[model samples]
Target: MATWPNAAIATLMETCGEAVSNAAWNAILNIVFPCPTYLVAPEQRLDSSRPDLTVYIVGENGVFFPFEGKPAKFSWEKLGGEVLGYCIAARPDAFQGYNYGMGGNGPECIICEYDGANMRYLYIHEGELCQSDKMHVLHIFRDAAEILNVLEFVRGAHV
Candidate 1:
């Protein structure tokens, strides 16, 4: 919709540490959704917790998507809870919601789906959880296309 080439997403995936990653992701996040048609609260609070952002359309009421990002030194143990918190707090209620979220750790990132009825999620794990139990993670170096595919899917799905 924005015609912002998905290939350009490579710039974001290439960032290294926390500050660089956060700023880079923030710039893309601001431009990706654009304006007039969308209302994005970049790096702002969504109720009680905060992700890197909260986003929703201009006329939407009580609906928002929370997004997060991390440096190369990332941990699902800490970030997972935060992402889930953002998802749980921001989801559209009354009828139903997508309950979807995405996060990045430097170039490595994952899209998350939360099944509220089932209380299930696959994007969270730490040393306590068995390595095999964790879902396969996508590395920027190895899964660039896959990552871009997912972003394209997001653009096509909603826009």
Candidate 2:
């Protein structure tokens, strides 16, 4: 539940000191938190290539949420293959992308155990359901809340 003027989001893009993808993620996180927040990259290996940043959302009891940032792309199936790597990481569970208007259906997230073998899955609902341009800012919040809800569900179930 954070609000940033459209101008601010543009300003963030204009003055980014990191990769476009990472900068987008950082800007969103900045809006989410009041103080300076730094995302810790997950510590795990995936098919030789991983995302630009892996953010950690650790609950009070040590449950970790791996938030991986991905650029919006056209290929959903291909992206799914790449996302499999995140599910394979050495972490409790994982979530990818910041809900930037990358509207077309693609791999949204991978939440799994850190055992290095067992993997569970959660697919973010496509943004197509919401009527608008695929990359609009408002849609980001709507989808992000859904992602967070799923994460909380997984946490509550003790999965």
Candidate 3:
């Protein structure tokens, strides 16, 4: 794992882009994950077409949550494919828990399981079914104390 001592919001903007959504993710992550975070930009080109980001904590815990920060409409079938892409590109090996799910080729969303983490892509559907696609990232906590610590961090940040 690469060490990022200068894991600041400015560094993330330099590496990622100047977008509110990216910034939101960074802020949220900085609050959620106590570990210093950094944005992993794609090589050679500089554009926000694809977002590559990863957060690292001490020891053998890391998570790659690459997201296409945009808004779009999708049907259940299209959403399933997109969710598959997100989960497949997540690189679960970086996290402690690693599991994923596929909706058995059904018209629903393809479920992805990471370790003990589970999320439904159909969360962004509509009305009673509308839900945001599962956000991919590491939410690591060794114990209740750590969870409280994270909560405090978020509360302090007011994110």
Query: Given candidate 3, what's the lDDT at residue 123?
Result: 25
Q: Taking the tens digit of each residue's C-alpha lDDT, what string does model 2 give over 135-159?
A: 2222233356654444444444333
Task: TM-score for candidate 3, please give it.
Answer: 0.35
Q: What tens-digit string does per-residue lDDT give for candidate 1 at 63-112? A: 45567888865896667667766767765451244465667677666665
Counting clashing residue pairs in each candidate, in order, gives: 0, 0, 18
lDDT of 2 at 106: 20
> Would you estimate the TM-scores of all the predictions?
0.66, 0.42, 0.35
Give the candidate order by descending TM-score. Answer: 1, 2, 3
Per-residue CA lDDT of model 3 for 1-159, tens digit only, reads 322122343233334433532444444445445554443332112132233233433354333443333221224455445445555554455444442322211111122333333453322122232223453221111122332342343223221
Which consecutive 10 residues in model 1 have the weakest lDDT in total?
A: 124-133
Global local distance difference test of model 2: 0.38
Point to the candidate with the largest lDDT: 1
Candidate 3, superposed: residue stretches over 4 Å from native: 1-18, 37-52, 58-62, 71-83, 94-119, 122-159
Off by over 4 Å in 1: 1-16, 27-32, 93-96, 118-133, 140-142, 152-159
RMSD of 3: 12.7
